[model samples]
Target: MESKDLVSDDGRITYRSGVAARLAGLSPETLRVWERRYNLSNVERSARGQRLYSAEQVRRLSLLKQLVDQGHAIGVLAPMSVDRLQELAGAAAGRPKAAGPLKVGVVGANLARRIAASNRDGSDLVVQHSWSHLDQVALTSPLADVEVLVIELSELHDSALPLILSAARACDGAAVVVLYRFCASATIRALRAHACLAARVPADVGELLSLCRSALAGDRLPPAPPLPTSDLRFDEDALFNIMASGSGLACECPKHLADLLLMVGSFERYSAQCASRNEDDAQLHNELGRAAGQARVILEAAMERLARADGLPLPPGLIK
Candidate 1:
């Protein structure tokens, strides 16, 4: 196999087995063996059963050879899906586009600026304007064009949720991530019942940025409804009626409490798995206990800070 054997055709290419072997920096026999053993090559065959190589295939083979030269195991890469292989190659070539943070028309300037500032290094779109500006953005922007919406409903005259819902209707598939300061569970539940998407963002810019990033990345758990409206105290009858209605008690107030419930649900899953598995029962129990305890500590610390920032006393019953 030699370099001179390589021939090009109008940006297309045809490879003699020997030439492909040379381009791949492998012996012709080794090339055939790779084709048979790993199915790694994307070579096509002419009607005469002669193998033909496209330029793309040649480039891929060259990349594969480079990876092998770098001590990567060919066997490990042999079964990679084409998409995964391309992603790896793109990453190696630094081709992945790093679009700045997805934009949002944040309703509250102070909170919006703080959240945007926190996510300076990550991707985000920050809108600093009045609620009316938010409405205009949502109504006129291309549908589902934005990934998340951060609105401060507490300061608004009209119900923010309706605007959000209208935006959600316009956007259709886009996620409407609402930001709330202090809202009752009933309000949150009402929003969720209408199938609006929302998440609880801490007052801290850092935490809010993290929340927004996770939401935009589709990596966070599906959020619960907004926090319970603070001013409204529901009577038992009212609570019971809400509970017996559609969505059941699980969707009831303190909308973001769903995050807690979901976290516990995960713990329950691991607990069940440990109980079902026969090996290392004691070790598993200890490991789970430690993880849960650590999580509890972190949650408590954050809750204390959040309580202070919001100027709200932590409900005694809410502390776990």
Candidate 2:
């Protein structure tokens, strides 16, 4: 079987033998012999009992023929698993399926091809000379339901980070993963804080492929859009009245920002609860720093200014 023999008609695979033979550069008789001797393909039979091969089967057989030409024994190769064989074939031919182990897009088609070769599957792939290609597909292709954004990401200046963040923010179901050669702790923190993901991986295609695969498999869904002002504005009487009675202030902030603050406050509450357990100077200092830093940042600019005006500049060095 050869790739060209399988025609897609109304989303169904229709096969033709003469065409397969012409594309494979072998006689139809040889294909039949391989099928009968090796049980190689899951060939379908038409209403008249003529043999037909699905697109996958055709692609596999084409690789098998090439491997045979390269002096690999068919009998020895036949025992290997289909996936392993396809991996080898995809490597050799550079025509990986879009929905493979990982989906990737690179700035250049050659880069995408190279990455695809190392990664070994293409569930959904698009190659572009620039970011505009990705933007176009994302705008128009229904199949471009991306979950992870993988890029070589070198030569990206500092100015691009905020733009990248905005794109990731717009990808409702996607998690952006940058494959960069050089990274620092500051970069990592910025990425996480902005809800983007990134990793430092090898320049080799294989590592890039593996990173993308792992990222897509574990990527989180994008957070929902912020509610409208009316929806987000809460009636404090319902939830905060009780807190006020307990000596807590009623706070108002964006929902997401509030959640971030509460995460920071949780650590403070934990430290306060455990003040008796770990009485070391470093432990108390660490907890206090984290709590104060979170509290100040969580406040609106006006409130923060007011607090500073009131002489709450915080201790010299802290998480803030």
Candidate 3:
């Protein structure tokens, strides 16, 4: 019944379906489809019949998603082992040989200068031009000439979603990369929904270069599908029975929930700062962000279930 059984000998972490989905840049329903249709991995089920995945399994799923994005069929890739999948990914990535420095356009002058300076060797990628605003990119012509368009934003806002989408469309096939200081799960979801790529602020220039190369090579993952509505049926009688039995007091569910919330919130802020200050730590920070986001989702769902069972309305902004 222990979820730790899903972990591997190397101490790789285990994740339930929701966390696995987020880690693999997929939806839970899509994971189910891949498992049911192609038997993608030897997924383990928890005592409660929930799906669990290991870190290695998530990595394989990510590779499969990347390969499928690059025009490889899922049926062909699904049966392949993780090593084979990685080989294919490497091969696809290797196909893009830079005849000249890959042309990159940036929406922020400072980011553009940083990337340009980072590419002093002039080998892999180059920042060709930079605009102070997204509107300037629209005013300019010959958008197709740019291989990649990089947009740096201070924060992920609801208003910026359309601008990012429009910028991507304007380029007419140029890969879009969004760099932001702070991002929410909803914002990441929105960016992916529009087929644009995103990375946390202070992202490594090398990684950004690699992403651009992949994008130019036609490596594009499909947008994740919307999550299915929960059909959970709250058991009010059982909850009351538990309370009547005095077990609820011993459990201290409220105190435990508050502690969890505080820990997650604190980690989230710390991760954001780490992401902003250290380029090398950006990936880890982003992972932490996703984990915190998933935790929040689960906690919110639990709160909603509790409210429903108690016949009480949840606090404003709690569910959203």
Pick the TM-score winner. 3
Best candidate (score: lDDT): 3
Task: List ranges where model 2 is wrong by over 4 Å.
Answer: 1-100, 107-110, 117-144, 219-320
- Sorted by TM-score, highest first, which candidate order results? 3, 1, 2
Report the C-alpha displacement of residue 68, candidate 1, in angstroms. Answer: 44
Q: lDDT of model 1 at residue 258?
A: 27
**Alpha-carbon lDDT, every model:** 0.51, 0.48, 0.65
Clashes of each: 15, 9, 0
**Native-vs-model 3 lDDT?**
0.65
| Residue 180 shift from truth in candidate 3, angstroms | 1.2
Question: Would you list the clashing residue pairs of candidate 3?
Answer: none
Q: Provide C-alpha RMSD values for all models, in order.
A: 16.9, 22.7, 19.9
Q: Write the per-residue lDDT of candidate 3 for residues 1-320, one digit (tens) a residue.
A: 53433554566667887788778888879888998999877877767787778888999989987887764557657889999989878976776654567888889745666565567686767767789887777667667768888897755555678777777777776878787656666677667556566666543578777767655674541112222223222222222222223223445564345335534544555565556666876777767766665676676567556555654444434434
- Write one digit per residue (lDDT tens) for candidate 1, span 44-156: 67566877776667667776776554333567567776566666555545523324555554554345545544565645555433343456656564544455555544322
By lDDT, is 1 or 3 better? 3
Candidate 1: where is the Cα deviation over 4 Å? 1-100, 122-134, 155-158, 197-201, 213-320
Which of candidates 2 and 3 reaches a greater TM-score?
Answer: 3
Span of 10 residues, lowest total lDDT, candidate 2: 220-229
Better of 1 and 3 by TM-score: 3
Question: Model 1, residue 318: what's the lDDT?
Answer: 44
